[model samples]
Target chain A: MIKLSELHLGILAALGGIVLLFASANFAPLPGQAYGAGTMPRLIGWCAILLGCFMVATSLKHLPEMAKPHLADWVRKPRLAFAALACLAVIVFYILFAETLGFLPTSFLGLLALMLVLRTKWPTAILASLATTLAVYYAFSRLLMVPLPRTEFLSFLG
Target chain B: MLIFEQAAALVFDPYVLGVILASAIFGMLVGAIPGLTATMATALLVPMTFFMDPVPAIAAIVTATAMAIFAGDIPAALLRMPGTPSSAAYVDDAYKMTQSGRGDEALGAALVFSAIGGLFGSIVLMTLAPALAEVALRFSSEEYFWLVLLGLSCAVFVTPSSPTRGLISLLFGLFVATIGMENPSGEPRFSFGNLELMAGIQFIPAMIGLFAISEILRTVTATIPRQKIPRSDGHGIFKTQWKNLKKYPVQTVRGNITGTALGILPGAGADIAAWISYAISKRFSKTPEKFGTGHVEGLVEAGASNNSAVSGAWIPALVFGIPGDSITAIVIGVLYIKGINPGPTIFINDPQTVYAIFMVFILANLIMLPLGWLAIRGARPMLSIPPSTLMPMILIFCIVGAFAIANSTAGIVMMLIFGIIGFFMEENDIPIAPAILGMVLGPMLEQNFITSMIKADGDIFRFFERPIAGGLGVFTILIWTLPLVMLLLRRRKQARLAT
Candidate 1:
């Protein structure tokens, strides 16, 4: 069963091993530092391992019922999953093309793609995305002076 | 204190006052929106801070963050949807009250309790930050190592959800912290030879990707092509609800204390504070059964706790360079960029600035009441707008916000990556807060721990040498241990009953 006790014991055991590994690490014979870098991490690593192991042991002894999960229960929703993926794709496109296309074009295109995937009206999506992109661009470039990538194609708009 | 005088000067400044008012309105608007967050507002505004004086910039950012934190409750109260993760715990409770025609009362309670919580946390920050920073200053690598361990240890017990999940999340975070570059050796320990891994994780973007982007992904799937908005029955949302609030002062106070304490811990933000406060309030409530079924006490506690957390989060920032949460992490970055280094030296070097910032805290909270009211009043009309019209705008903002963080295309890529992670995690019912916490604290934990062991020559006892470290370590153990002990006792009782 997936009770807190079992989880605790598992954590403790894992942490214990980590601690030992760090404790055994050589901090001395390294370059010109008063203390070796591995020293603090190793110490904390040990503490974490000990504490984690203790938790696993404690959980196994009690609250065993908490570990029992209903594996049969599963999400059947498809639209939600698809939408989530679409959002991801748009973001990736924005990141990959933001440099070549510039902030406004890239953001506008990302928003347009997301809007299409979400099934928004074309006019509303296009206008809103463009306006929003322009506003943020102005706010950042003119007001904040955070250097934004500008393309040679868009330079004609100036 | 001589520091208090400069605080007075800063508080009296009209520009500072105006920005606080602007921030409150901004916070309410963002918080009221379903997809937006205070962190986004803060990140977007960080660039603007480069143009202003330090005092005004800090005033604007802090005020907005505090107000926005409170603003999240508005949508949660009005719609069944939560505006932010911090408000998620109370959405059902508050929305249930709204459905039963107690929307005004619920709104009023949230407004008042948020102010109280913010005030309480601010007081704690003002009274304790300088002193704490002085102690934190004494911490060389050895002390910091212990302190970080104490914090991680506390997470084992302090998470508002299942203790096991909390500890698992903490461990996961600790593990991630081990990735990337090594300080002592200047050699990459966890990078596995990747150049990108050498810089470690680009923490802020990773956090944004995990928490913000992931959230978007999860919601995208479940978002009905046409989501239904349940209309309110012509109720007066702005009407004050003093009668209900007066009935639960104790709940509000407890919420404030818990929220403030949680907020003071780095990476533990308002969401955890709200959940923890709500849980504690429920435990002590005489009518515990009414909790998820529209309990006013739950709302008061949740609202107060989250708002208070905003102020409590400032404590770590002011005292040490360490940020209490992600937003504060960005704030620390801003402070450092402005040449105003935090830590013990800050108070000694510029007591007046410290006091001034504290005064901003008080002023921001007070200003929040009116600002919150106006935003709630104004945004109600906007809330009715269909998601189809709004979703595109939000998507644009997300892209811009992502690009704006580091002005790099790679940051946008990072956002998408984390967004996918966040979405999957959410669908699986895994909390994203821990991921953000991990991203923020991972490097700090690694650096401090490594430094400490090097100092003590691998003697773990060096962590316990200081009274503070010892106390913190013990406290961390107590948190994880107590839960296990209680669970054991309950199981024994159950077994006896069964037999």
Candidate 2:
């Protein structure tokens, strides 16, 4: 876990730098109109800088009250962490495969993989995963008219 | 009379009826699923609605969402799991009601009261929105600027524990809003050398990240060891009493009215509406202690208030083209994409469309009553599903939902970012609401402020000089100061008493 003081200091420094970057950019001539792209960013940059300063001050003065991040706890629960990572992997695979494998097969694969990871019984997992995949496929395709990718494999099956 | 006839025609349409029924059922299913919020459900549906008639689309979407919100109570009451944040308040009470074999009664009361509240909210919206818009038409950009400021200020209470952090979050959101090309000019700002950034952060993906993925991460982190409470095969699973409803009519009406009024207020959404109504009811109750311990009145009030919020949310969406909550924001986006302008001029330009949407509300609420009844009757069977099964199913929804939005691997990546950030934030009791409010309102504030500043020729004082802007500034100041004043007064009183 990062110390609150250190976190505050780092966050503020980063915010200040980001603000300065915006301020250094060529600014618009008018307040609302854009002579350049930098105007609104500058305003937001200043607000961030000010808030960062306040956060730094508050953290310094009330260190006990400052919040500490709990990355360690997450690290301790390796299974939970793995589950979360598995979730991300499943989603990434779904998106990648949606175009190639198409919606149905890909969705079913993603669900089945996730179900296994979640420790669902194999029989129920296969059944429910298939039902959900088919239901969503029908809803999106026939009812909502969303154009899901049609792979050659899927077309051949049809 | 013309509007009435138009509305009546909408009511009589069979396709319109079908749309409402289907949408509401879908919404309920969406809401009942853990981590699948009304906003996510609405966003997923919003784009599809583009192909449909605006009237039926709006009706179906609204019906689905409203029922979905109520359906959240189902999980809360039965499983001690809140499907939506708005249902969070009554979760304890409703769950307790279930444990005591009154779960069916609690669900019944919530369903009936929510129906009543939705009707009341629509009434308030029908009366108040047009009048407000008529008044709002008089507002120049100066007033518009103030109104936005006032809205941001009201949002301050949305995360009361950390006001400074809230303001910082808002500023960050505003900064994100600036990333895209300038609205007034074609010039790009904050693109940081990326074309995708030039379009700015898409609200839907950002929302999906914040609400859906954030929740999944939080749940994974705080994995509660499932308690094995004996499953009661209680018989009165769908029993609700008109007698009980009549007994608590005052509570239901009060909750509905308060929820609607709060809903109409910019920046106040269903979560606040439910909280505020619950508090008011508790305050006025003769036995306040009865709250949080399965009080039927508390359940009735919370349900009604959240229901009213759905209607109340529409006032801003329909009249001003501003969404009061995430769901309404998606609806406003839908209207924008559909080329249906929703401002004061919209009423005059498309009265029939406006009436059609309103008529949908009337029909949606009516249909929700029967649909709600059937769903509640069928809920106990749903409770039989083991958490193990649910965890996988929800995980699938979360995965597909995150991916389907932009088809970007970046969205899934962003979901991971927000989920981690959100889990940590919740762990520290730092509150997730401010971060979300920051994400939601940040860009709007920037755009309005930049636009106002441009109009004022860099004169910062001009922001304070306009009547509406000045008024909002003063109100913001008052809101910011009054809490400090109360704290100081309390400290002083404590000192004097000790002396």
Candidate 3:
């Protein structure tokens, strides 16, 4: 957990602003006008640059205190850190596998894994995951008409 | 009269009414939970809104947000934990009231006054929005540019943290809005050749990632355990509310007025409303010393203020397409999705739908009384649900919702990326509201600026030639310069003091 202080965040923002300006430079101006696609992005870049500079200046007196990064209590604990990662991992898992595995199986797996990681009992995890996956699939796909991805492997269930 | 009848028919239909009822219950459930904000509740409801008629969908959000805002008081009173950020203003007073066995009074005051405040705001919305829209019908690109800039200025200045950080967040959002080909030039600037990126970031998934996912991350990293709710005193929820109302009539009216005014201001919302109203209540109270010691006086005023502000926020959103707060920002997105563009033109185009919406606000507030009563009785059980168990379910909902946005994996990827950005932004004390507002208004700002530039042939002074545009421009500039001027004046004052 590399906690960012005001100074670090400011520097990062300033650098990001510069990068945006350069990238936006490639966008040619619109025809018959002075402004173009680059206009807003460029405006934002300058604003960011000014904001970053202001942040740095205001915090200069407390620069030492503002620059040090401190870990949150959960970040210091491996279990909690993993819990946070598992939350992200589930999303990543769905992104990678949902289209291939289908919405039901992929979602069920993600839910079950997360419940267990969050320390739910196996039975609770299994039952809750099963119920929720079916309910969500129905409510979204059937009721709301949102098309959840169909599984190539598990075609019958969906 | 005929239009009112048409709107009444629209609102009273089985489908829209059912949606409202279901969303109200959903709102109560979400609001009674600590760490789940009203804005998150709105975000979560968006996917469902994607399927329905525009009236029902807007009805759903309207009902849910009003219920959620009021329901937040349940946890605040019972557990000393604010269910939503807006409820936080008077949490100490609410908790103390419960401890002193005046729990019924505290909850009652919160529910009743919230209803009163919400109704007042709705009436104001009903009356003021159309008139404002009529005035806005005359606004050209120059006027819109100034208005958008003013809105952004409000967002930066009204945050709970450093203005510089808020400005950074606002800039980040502005940058994000410039991602696709909808700018002045049709050429995509930052799409990186990704097809989905060319369409630009969908506000729904990005919003879910920011409010929902970042909150989940924060909860996981939280060191504090859930607080135990106090046992019920077995008193009727609304029994003492009448007495309190009689005693605090001035406070109630003042709070309602203050909240509605603030709500009408772009970028300021219910949370700020509650805080300001609570402070005002204390200042005006005869027994100001009793405020934090199990007091119901402050709770009454602030609770009313929050709910009213929720209604107040819709005024600008409906009239000008500028969001009054985070919730209304999401509402504007929904409005656009429904093909009911918000502006003065909306009044001319969809008068019936506008009336239906106004009716929904009144209905949502009216029902808050009964629904809020039930929630109070059920608060203990709801709050007892462990965060560890609850969080996983919410995360699943977030993932599905992200995927459901465009029915593509690309939306999920955007969610993940924005989730990280949101988490990082929160960690750095950059206010998220500005970013959300920036995203909502970014294109509007750019579109107007470009059109005005073309209209004026690159003459900057033309932007200020029109009376309304000049006034708005001056106001925005003044707001932007206020801090810097204050800083300079402070330095000079300090030098004088040292001498």
Candidate 4:
């Protein structure tokens, strides 16, 4: 919902770059070498910082406008924003519950909830999600042989 | 000729042929869906490629990517949504063509020209690859570093967006590549003590999140009314293309050449090729003012350009173990997974696979004709799928695709995080392609830089001592500084005019 102007993004980038430089300050270099694990990262940090500064400098003439905060249109519409958040929520939910709930139940719940949030009818959402979850499970685990986590308790679905 | 027979034998197997057919369908379906990209399709194919043999696996990716790049034109022509960024270059022209009741012709030209362009690039790839590999074999670390840098430069500067944003995206990608413990020091740089972080970010999940999930999020938030596809006037698709081909033979050849050249450049891909070719097409057009008004001229050129560029990108990937585009970046990963490490020695060590890959390119482009025709015929149904239902379906696939990568939840978590980042970056106008390229090329850049630095004993000027390295170094430096020079000159000229 938040729309950060280039100026703000630039500032954030600069701060991030600085923080990266500090965080990797103690990364041990390869033996008898000055550059190592931190070398490329350090170079990236510097580049980011420079780019951030460039962004800030170029926008300096429009500082007032750059400082003005704005909200994306989706932010004004809670329903749309919630639908977007629902996407992230589904992923987080599956991650937290997949092992305990098993892949099927967790995936089904996630898919159905997302579909319903997006305003699909409950019947269609449930049916489609059920079919999708089953199809995906079979395609990946059976056909592709990815070892998706199985529920310890939900043996039938497992 | 014996080599051709061997390659033909390898690819003609039922298993490999089946892979090609299945992947072609997958490519078309994925490409027809608005907001999904060919690169995303390749990323999704990685896990499936894991179960197959080397030839079939590589064949699947090759066929899928070539088909997908061409298929992206379908939605661009019909719905004005541009299924992939490559199609975005001339989406307006395509949609206008549809609006003016030339939808069938626009699509027809796109399919035919795309096939021809892809074929042209494939031929170039076939003929040029072995010789190029010989040259690449002579490349030292200094040459490679400059080449990668040049590629990154092309990625940033070539886009129609702000170069700053492109740089930001690219830097983010390079930073992502630096996350693990496999750097020059073998010390974990940014793991933060997380075990998964030590292994580094999985490329496929991150790519899926960046492209697919972010696209879903964008679709959900978008307000544009989905265009109602104009009913086909039944003018027949390919009927008009013959005249178009004869009319624009020069543009066709130019587009193919530009696309293939750019494609061969690491980090430059079909999107840039299409854009550049479309620009060139307009520049050379007798009726340049007719552009952006449903003119098939731009579409014909750009359509051909994008597919050819798709083939062109394989040159560096096959010869130098460097990716020519995001799709080929994933292909390189698959190639490594299949134990077909892409490099100069690949021609010497695995001639059949190399030739088979070339043969696959030709076959993929040829197969695109019938499959593409079917996709155009079926575009209406594909376009009818509402975003509300479709987004959720794609999201599930993204989840499963990510999860399938390592059979770990880490991949999913990475996807979610990247999805958010990608959505954020898109909203801010930072291009995602450069970031993807950066991620793909970052390790190569660092590896080459460090190796060169160590070899040269930290003498900076030593980087330009070698002939080819010197030439490449000068070219890269010029590319970086040329804009600045031109900018200053333009300002001075404006001052003089004002006075």
Candidate 5:
């Protein structure tokens, strides 16, 4: 991930506010009233624009330092960066496959993979993954009746 | 008397008691771990609470937060690593006491004083909230608009950060709240044609992402070496507390007052309360030189203050539906989800439930005593759990918790997106509390604003026509402009000096 300086963030905020203002411009007002759904968004957009300008003005004094954007420290370290990406990957993996392959397999695989990436031993990772997957399965699926995706093979377990 | 009995019956049920016990353990576990906050604990508990009845659901949260705040002291005393931000205030005093073989006393002061302070705040909540609700019941849309604005203003201004950054966060949250078709005109503002987006951003999933997932990312990517947990003599966890209580009665009471007061203020919570109480203790102490070097004086005061602040934060949340801190911000969301709309009307409409909540507060504080002691005794094993192992487990919980909220992949997707946003916000020194506050209060602010505007036929000055609304509006505007005024005055003074 990139570490954005205040100037960059301010610029982004200003652009975002401008986009909001244009998007809300077409929202029809309530019948016979001066405002509608667009009113609050417009107000927020204006505030964001003003705030962005204020931030840019205040940050300009440190322009030499503030204009430069860099990578976060974690992004510079391969191992840690991998771990961070692996965490996001696990979530994405779960989202894509939880419904298809079921919560048990997807969660177990995701947890074990992330654990292994984080340097947990294979045995500990496997056992912890299996145990946590089952525990969560029962806690949410059975006790709480959340109807989490289930595998035919794990039907009896459910 | 009947209402009190009904409230007691609601609280003492086997199920309610069981939920309290379970959440007490859960709170202790989460709070005793470094980097997991009481707010995180509350966020994690929300999904489970979503399954239970309103009373037990609320009981679980009430018990968990009270326990989490106290449990934070355990790691602070033993490892010089505060388990939560609230414990950061007196970490030096607590750790020095441990190093000097007074660890038991330090932990005991934290546990006992925390419970005492919680009880004091609960009593204050019981006595004060209903009385204030009477006044709140008379408020109208104009009054609500200013009140919500005042709360949002406090969230941006009172927090220890650049107000500009806080306002940016607040604006982002308000914008997020505008995504659904829940607005007055029933028009989809930013749904982008997605079915789920039309329902608005899911509060629980967003919160889980903001607090839990971002915390996991930060913890996993950090380069700080883990410190060895210090061995402490855990015997007599409560033995010295009595002596300390007697010795520092004034400090204890003062801490309770300060914490409760701060807690009642919008956006300020236990963390700030602890820091302020510790400062006050030192400011008034004759032996201030001993503050950072194994002194228990500051611990007694700040420990009490943090827990008291937890209970004090509920004041505005219960009475006005304005959250006093991030925890209550989440609670307000839960209450609305449960169809128990908070505000002064709740006292009149659901008096029994209101009293039951009051009862839960007292019960939660009392139960913190035994649970806090057990946490202190078992701190070594709990602290030994590696982040590499724990982070994955927590991630799975966050994933499932987010998914379970609405039983859709969209919730998990939202969590992931917000997780990255939260991480970026923290990296940029933007405070998350105001954002959470803004998200929770955004719709209400807009609804009240539009209602007042329509009622006044776009006459903006009529917002101040009602005396109460006028007072609140003026106060909110003053809070907004005071800092700018101060900056201008200081600049003028500087110019004169330079000339």
Candidate 6:
């Protein structure tokens, strides 16, 4: 992840406020009323704009230090960076594949991959992943009736 | 008397007791572990609570949070690492006590005083919330608008950080709340034609992402090395508490009073309460010089405080639907999910449930003695579980928990997006509590503001026409302006000094 400086955050907030103000400009008001849905958004936008300006103004005194965006320490470590990306990938993978591949397979694979990346031993990782996958499957699907995705391959287990 | 029986029957059932026991254990584990907070435990428990009835659901949360706050002292004393932020205030004292082989005394004081404080807060909540709700019952939209604004203002200005950053976080949350067509005009604001977006962000998923997933990301990518847990000579966890109680009667009462007072304030929770109570204990003590070097005075005071604040936070949440802390912010979300609309009317309509919750507070604190002692005895193995193995398991839970909210992938996607946003916010030193509070209160703020506007025919001055509304409005405005006045005064004084 990138570590943005105060100035950058302020600038981004200012831009965001501007965009909000313009986007909500077209919202129609309530019947026979001067304000509508747009009123709250517009208020938030103005507040954001003022806050961003204040932040920017306060940050100007240390302009040189405030302008530089630095990378967090973990971003420089290859192992830790991989661990972070691997965590995100597991979630993204589950989103894309859970419906087709079923919760059991998708969760097991994701958990296994993440555990391995985090340097857990292979045996413990596989066992823990499988156990967790099944436990979550039963808890959510059977107990809570959450309707977690299922496939023919895991139908027997269910 | 009949209502008390009804509430007792509601709380003492087999299912509710079962739920309470399970959540008690869960809260202890989460609170005893470093980096896993009481709020995170509540966020994770929401999914399971989704499957429960109202009483059991609330019982789970109430019990879990109480246990978590006390269990946090375990790691704080044994490892010099607070299991939760609430325990950070007296960590030095607790750890030093352990170093001096007074670990039992330290843990015992924490357990005994924490229960005392919790009971004190619960009594206050029972007596105070109903009375306040009576007044809240007569409030109009104009008054509600000002009240909600006051709560938000307190969230920003009361935070111990840059108000600009807190305001930025709050604005971001309000903007998120405006994503759907839940407004008075019924116009789609930022949905961009997607059905899920039109429904607005799922509060559960967003909460899980913000509190749980962001924590996972930070833990996984952290560079800090884990510390070794110190050896503890544990025995007679309760033997020494009677003497300590007798010795520090004033500190115990003061802690409870200070904690409950701070807890009633919006956005100040157990963590802040503990810090403030510890400071007060030092300020008022004769031996203030012995504060940081294993002094039990500060520990007794702060330990009582953090737990009491847990119960204190429920006051505003139950009475006015304004959360007193982040934990109650999550509780408010859970309440809404259970189809229990929080506010003054809840007292009239669901008096049994309200009383049951009060009962749960007392039960949770009383049971903390046994549960807290067990956690202390078994702390070593629990802390030894490497984060490498635990983070992945937690992530899986987060993924499935998000997915279970609406049985859709859209919830998962929302969790992912908000997780990254929460991580970024924390990295920038922006507080997450105000954002959570904003998300919870934004719709209420908008609805009341618009309702008052319509009722008053767009006349701004009419907002102050009602006496309660006028006083509240003026008070809210004063809170916002007072800080600026102080800032200007200080700056002018600095200039004069320079001259």
- Tell me, by lDDT, which candidate is best: 5
Q: How well is each residue in B1-499 modelled by candidate 2, as lDDT tens digits?
A: 8877987787568887777778888888877764456876787787668788778778868888888888888877876556666776576688888877777788887787888888888877777786753444455566556555554554444343466655655564555566667544556665777776777676545544555555555545445654444454454434455866777888888888778866775556787677666756665788777777878887788799998988988887788887767788888877877789888788889888887777777777777788887887777775566655655565555554555556555555556566555554445444454445445555555556667767787787888886766886777677668778998999999999999
The order of the candidates by DockQ, greatest first, is 6, 4, 5, 3, 2, 1
What DockQ do the predictions score, one after another? 0.32, 0.37, 0.59, 0.63, 0.62, 0.66
- Looking at every candidate separately, what fraction of the true A–B Cα contacts under 8 Å does it contain? 0.53, 0.43, 0.77, 0.78, 0.78, 0.91
Candidate 1 lDDT by residue in tens digits, B448-471: 665666676778887778787777
TM-score values for chain B across all models: 0.73, 0.72, 0.66, 0.73, 0.65, 0.64
Candidate 2 regions exceeding 4 Å error are A1-49, A59-71, A156-158, B1-10, B13-16, B30-113, B124-130, B164-171, B182-187, B227-359, B376-388, B406-410, B455-471, B495-499
Best by DockQ: 6
lDDT of 1 by residue, A1-158 (tens): 11123464465447555754654375452565555445445644665676566666666655556355432111345655566566767767766777788776887787877777777788877887788778867765765466777767777643
Regarding DockQ, does 1 or 5 come out ahead? 5
Off by over 4 Å in 6: B1-131, B158-160, B224-361, B372-382, B459-471
**Per-residue lDDT for B1-499 in model 6, tens only?**
8899999999999999999999999899767755467886787788888899999999999999999899889877875656676786687788888877788889899989999999999999999875643554567898879867876775675343577888888898899999898999888879999999999888767866776677778878888865444555555689888889899999999999878866776666787678767866876799977876888998999899988888888998998898878889999999999999888899889999999999999999999989888887787454466878878887887787777667899988998998888888878787665676577679889999999988999898999999989998998898789779999999999999999
Give the CA lDDT, 0 to 100, for residue B347 in model 6: 88
Instruction: List runs of model 3 lying over 4 Å from the truth.
Output: A63-73, A150-158, B1-118, B121-131, B223-361, B372-382, B459-461
In candidate 5, position A40 carries an lDDT of 95
- Looking only at chain B, model 6 earns a TM-score of 0.64
Give the clashing residue pairs of candidate 6, or none: none
Per-candidate TM equals: 0.72, 0.75, 0.74, 0.80, 0.75, 0.74
True contacts kept of 1: 0.53
Clashing pairs in model 2, backbone N/Cα/C closer than 3 A: A31-B454, A32-B453, A32-B454, B173-B442, B174-B442
Q: lDDT score, residue B469, model 6?
A: 92
> What local lDDT does model 4 show for residue B426?
79
Candidate 6: CAPRI quality band: medium
RMSD, one per candidate, in order: 6.4, 5.7, 6.4, 5.1, 6.6, 6.7
Candidate 6 overall Cα lDDT vs. reference? Answer: 0.83
At residue B342, candidate 5 shows an lDDT of: 90
Give every prediction's interface RMSD: 5.6, 3.8, 2.0, 1.8, 1.8, 1.8
lDDT on C-alpha atoms for all candidate structures: 0.68, 0.68, 0.81, 0.83, 0.84, 0.83
